[model samples]
Target: MSNFNIFLKQGTCSYCNNSIVIQRKHSGENLCPECFQKNIEKNIYKTISKYEMLKSKDRIIVALSGGKDSISLLYNLNIIQNRTHNSKPIIALIIDEGIKEYREKSIKKAKEFCNKYNIEYKIISFKDKIGKTLDEIINMKRETPDYKYACNYCATIRRRLLNDGAKELGGNILAMGHNLTDFAETYLMNILYKRLDIIANQYFFKEENDEINQFYIKKISPLIRIPEEEIFLYANIKKLDYYPSHCPYREKDPIIRKRVLDFIQECKKYSPEIEFNLLNGFLELSKTLYYHRKKKNHSLCQKCGYPCGNGKICSYCSYLLEFS
Candidate 1:
């Protein structure tokens, strides 16, 4: 034998010794690539059942941004809803944040997915509703000292639109594509920002009352136990044609949300259970906040007739006035 061995070790799947890229344990099949996709869908169905997010009469409106998470949510919800014999069907609500590059691409993907699934879809634009798109508002505010960040504008507008749009479409609840990692990151961000009310409202699911229910739509996320990476993988394996670009504003954000995400990523290095622990943190913190803050009675927003606090104007209205 030669002193130096020149043979390269050919790698195979650890589970079955079949040549493959991924080696993780899965639910069925030889599970090279296509098989893993099926496993994710099955897992999503189980998660939905375990959480009881859906019901016989729920009209679920999926918030589809054409991103990996939203596409995965739409796909899985479409499958599970049909099997449950749910009376109310699921629809997709796509909100365009007015970024030409981001919104345009995402809208195409959203329309495509909806077409393939034969699901009802609607698109709401900032320009049509607010009289100005992000590009217009940014240009107007470019010379001003009070230039708001992209996420600040995008989040405020989208939240209001989805709630309003879902209600308009006769939806009983709004389903979002938020996963465990997203929830954990958001939870930490709220703590850093001292947004107690947000944390209180962001518990796993919220019950809709006549006051807030009329103004804001009830929301649920069945994928909270799934990780972000898994969502991406699931979407790809399902051959979901999702908008593959990130919002330009994300990198531009100098906010703590990004840092919080990084912190979660670092913690995940040692233990994959960090996300589940953080989710537990959210559950614990939400109960604490709910107990501390007295529930406020809501009235209709004079402008839109949605549920509002004692104030006649809602956050969406306040956001609109910010531009003026």
Candidate 2:
């Protein structure tokens, strides 16, 4: 037999002397199922501690979409909160964007998970808060001459709604489920677009004023160090009840973000550590940009009184106006 076949025949887990389940190419570790799951949890815990993402008194609102990443994050954070001394129970906040077949299925899975764990959860929809569902919004704007992609509208509205909803629920921190690949894609997109201001805004150690905190909850991503594929693996390995489909819009949209994501995924085949490198670059570059860039005083949106970044209207409001 060949050396490759021989190596596979003798492949035991690097962590435990058990049969290997998966080999992480980037780290060159052969891991059994149990050790792999444990390592993921430990890495999440370490990331939380390293970034000071949580405080004992802080109320956390997890952005749950019933997908693999969010479900995995909620599962881990639930365990952590239960063990912590005085942390408030994390709340799962689901955004119902009103996509007919898509959002309904995901929301069902989200509710089931929350019910199983007896976690407090809330559902807010674009229809109730923004006067129209995402589908309706798309139907209205799809034919407009200046129409943008569905993802752009969905992201802007979802972000504002999440922040407002979390604040309304008295949460001081909002935990997101974005993974390393997500961050890398976003970082590369912003770099390509030369959106340095956006990069600076992502600085983890940026000072928080009470005014900004009132409108925007402190956001953290405990899963930022994990990759998208690994989260998918962990979720499946743990038998998590997560939705196994991507948003239909994401699949069908002709957005540049999709191209950027494709580029990153393609690069990963050649460079296993490319995502981690981009993440590190984002961390350092964001910090440097945050400190060195000239501070632009935030101006409140005339309609909503939230910071508009020296503009008279925030992107959320501008989109709403366009929809009108």
Candidate 3:
């Protein structure tokens, strides 16, 4: 037999003594393919149950980008839904940012995956909704004095699209594929910029009021506990047909989010549990901040009737005005 086959056959799983297929460095666990897959699925299930993320009556709108993290999340959610009694329907929502060569391929994969699994899906486009593709937005704003990065524009528009699409579809919960690394990186970015309002708004444990529920669908990230690399591995091992490429703008733009992610990865070299620590800190800090600000009344945006922090128009509407 070849050396690769010999290596695969030699080692046993740390938990089951079955032949190992994956060796996790941070956890120091050698797992067989079956065990690794099962462990990931179990973690996702536990995350949902622990956070009360889903209810039987909730219509879940999955933000499917056709990437590994999203593909894994959707697949696991389907499994969980299947095992439950009277499970709510899951609808895959895709936002086409209109990036040439990038979004087209991913959307194709997303449609194929949804079709193969018999899941209902909807597609909305930046051109249709915002009157501009991401490429056009970048070109239009690149030379402006207060020019925002491509990621900023992309995230802002995509978030609004997802929320509006889900709400229109009568979805009660919107599930995203933000993994552990993303959570950690975002937490650090908020801290660095001293954006306490953003942090408070993102507090996961806040009691939902009518004003909040009316506009914002409850958002959940069941993959938040799992690292990005692990999700990539899981998607590949499970033979999921997912888009392997990332957004072209992500690497090219000098965004702070990329820098923050790089910093977290560097810290992981010296301290393996740094990401977990950041996540824990975020949980505590967000809870404290939420309680501190919970009593403050939220004003509705004049244009969209969504909850706004201070201004009469919500940020989404404000951005829309800029494009108009």
Candidate 4:
């Protein structure tokens, strides 16, 4: 046996006798390249179907960051949409955060992928919509009291822009690329901060009243069950053309997101199934909180008239006002 095959013999795939490419510690499944790819895609399909995240006629706006996760999501969604009769065309929405070298290169790759696949795409920029790029926002907010980290601004603005962009394109559902790692990290962060309202607001099965259904396009993350590294492996094994870089600010900022992610990784070393546990806990906690807080009325943002949770001004509007 060759050296590679010898390595494979140590842990052959659970599904087939092929060389093992991935060892899923969380589930204790050793998967080869082909089986691993299929498993990831199958999980994505299952996630969407279980959540009722999409409909045959629903227009999907894929939030393409040009990263591995988003690229994998867009590719899979395109394949699924193509096979479904009467499904609306999947549109790739690229948000340019204007992060100098980082976003520009990613946008280029995004455009290339869209062109190659003939997927219709739209590009929105922070400069055009918010009158300032993310870099500018960070610099401006540096000295202000209670100033949040770069990620705080970036995530809030990017979310609002993606929602509005999808709505503008006549989309009913917006698909995102947040993987299991992201979801688990965010859940832990919220728990650490005692942010029950945020958890309640994110209830997956919250009743969609007419008011909410009118203003908010339902958001779905099909890859929420898949880990981040698996997505990276899938992208590479599939020979996908995606930007292989992280945002510079992500590492530089002293943000809770990074710390929480690190903590989760550290915990995973000791307990392989920790992330899965966190995800399950988040689901139950969010559902319970949603029922308890269902009757609570959310105030509209004074400036934009959008649901602003407990605050009079929404975070989106607040950021815009501060930066403007």
Candidate 5:
């Protein structure tokens, strides 16, 4: 052997002595992989307990995008339930936007994970429900006057689809895998667009309203506190298999949403806790927003019978009528 000394790549937990390949920068722990997992799981448990997101018998339908954040959430929730044998079992709900190549791969991964966990998996396609796929919506919008951003149509339709799909599948609680970055971006977007009503409703928790309760599924975000970077890191650390590409339309959106996110990320170099601060601001403003939305609930949409403002038809009904 050569007379050279090599530094041991000591894979040891910063938090504990358990071996780990990764380390959490914020927590400053050389934690064993399991301990790192536990750290994130603790956040999920805290959120659930704080918000009371789930009830004993409430059927939960998770919005799994075949991404690491969602996979992590499903895995954690499963582990929690397995530990407690808690109220009702969880299911995964994936809405196919009908992006053949993108969705084909993602949906495959989603189904694979769901099957492995033995969790019930349900896929609702835009074509089946909306009579047109996302591609159709994009093309239609592109041709129309007063065109909306691509994300605008995609998000709106997807939101409606998620609510309806959850309801159709007997899902009282719809868990979304929106991480901290997503939440901050949404908050900033609302501020930019001056959509106070949406801002008010952006809180992680919400009290039920009769009109909304009638048509909408109760949505929750267990990954609300986890940073996007952390989720990406965790997924890589755990060797989680997920679709890696972004939606092609995302880059083409005319809106400033992505720019805002980029700014936030750049600011994070100077202050990593900026997202947390924004989250706090959102929570503080949400109470005022809740009262505002409740007061703003006006007439019902005549077309679909859902609540609508000054319009003859609700946004959902109008989009359907116009598109189909």
Candidate 6:
């Protein structure tokens, strides 16, 4: 027996009798590269099905960022779409937050992937919509009192632009590439700050209403069950031409979200399934909160007609006013 085999007596894949290439710590399953990748795709399909995230006639808009998670998602979804009977081609929506060199590099990779696959794509920018680049926004607001982190501004602007852009492309469903780690981190952050309303807003199975649908595209994260590291591995294994760098603001910002993510990572060392636990907790809590919130009528923004809590203006419109 080889040294590797000797080290792991059960060195064969759990799904098949092939040499194991990766062992999933969460499930304690050893799998070969082929099987591992297959498992990831299978998980994605199952997540969509379990959540009822897609309908046959729904126009799909994939939010492609050219990063590992988003690229892997687009590749898998493309394959699935191709296999579906008489399904519409998925459109890729790329949002350029105008972070200078950072966003340009990713946009290049995003365009290349879309062109190579012959997928239709639309690119929107903060400059065109918000009237300023993120760099410019930060520079203008950094010294102001009550100035939020760059991530705060970027996320608000990007979310509005992505939703509007997707709707403009006539898409009813917006597919996101957020992985398990992202979900866990966000949920933890919300929990820390007692943001139950945000958690409630993310409930997976909300009945479709025309009023809400008109303003907000139905967003789905098919990769919600997959881990971040696994997505990175899958992207590399598939040899995807992805931009491997993160946004500069994400690393530089001393945001609580970053600390929460670090805490999650630290907990993962002792508890491999920590993220899964957090996700499950979120699922149950969000479901309960969703039904609870359903009793009250949602307050729509006076300007945009989107939900804005008790306020007359939504955060998106509020940010626009600030920029204006």
Q: Can you write out model 1's per-residue Cα lDDT over 1-324, one digit (the tens) per residue? A: 122122222455434555543433222233345445666777777777776777778889999998888988998888777877636678899988789787898899899989989998999988888998987877777667877666777787888888888999999889999998898898888888888877877765455456555456778887887778767666665678888777877777586688888899888777768888888888888877765663655577787776655689876787688776
Considering only N, C-alpha and C atoms within 3 Å, which residue pairs clash in candidate 4?
Answer: none
User: What tens digits encode model 3's per-residue C-alpha lDDT throughout 228-268?
Assistant: 87787778778999998879999888988898888888898
Where does candidate 3 stray beyond 4 Å?
A: 1-11
**What lDDT tens digits, residue by residue, belong to model 6 across residues 1-324?**
011221223488998898877777778999887888899889999998998998878789999999988899999889888988999999999998889898999999999999999999999999998799999989988999978989998988899899999999999889999999999998998899998888988999888788778889999999999989888878876889999887989888789998898899889889999999999999999999999878777888888787878789988888888988
Report lDDT (CA) for all predictions: 0.76, 0.88, 0.87, 0.89, 0.78, 0.88
Native-vs-model 2 lDDT? Answer: 0.88
Predict model 6's lDDT versus the native.
0.88
Worst 10 residues of 4 by lDDT: 1-10
Report the Cα RMSD per candidate: 6.1, 3.7, 3.2, 3.2, 5.2, 3.7
For model 3, the local distance difference test gives 0.87
Better of 1 and 6 by TM-score: 6
User: Candidate 3, which ten residues in sequence have the lowest lDDT sum?
Assistant: 1-10
Ranking by TM-score: 2, 4, 6, 3, 5, 1
Best by lDDT: 4
Q: What is the TM-score of each candidate against the true structure?
A: 0.85, 0.95, 0.94, 0.95, 0.89, 0.95
Across 1-324, the per-residue lDDT of candidate 2 in tens digits comes to: 011121232478997798866778789998887888899999999999998888888899999999989999999999999998977999999999999899999999999999999999999999998899989998998888878878989999999999999998899999999999898999999999999888998888878777777788899999999988778778877999998887888878788988998899889889999999998898999999998873667779999888886679999999888877
Whole-model lDDT, candidate 5?
Answer: 0.78
Model 2 pairs in collision: none
- RMSD in Å for model 2: 3.7
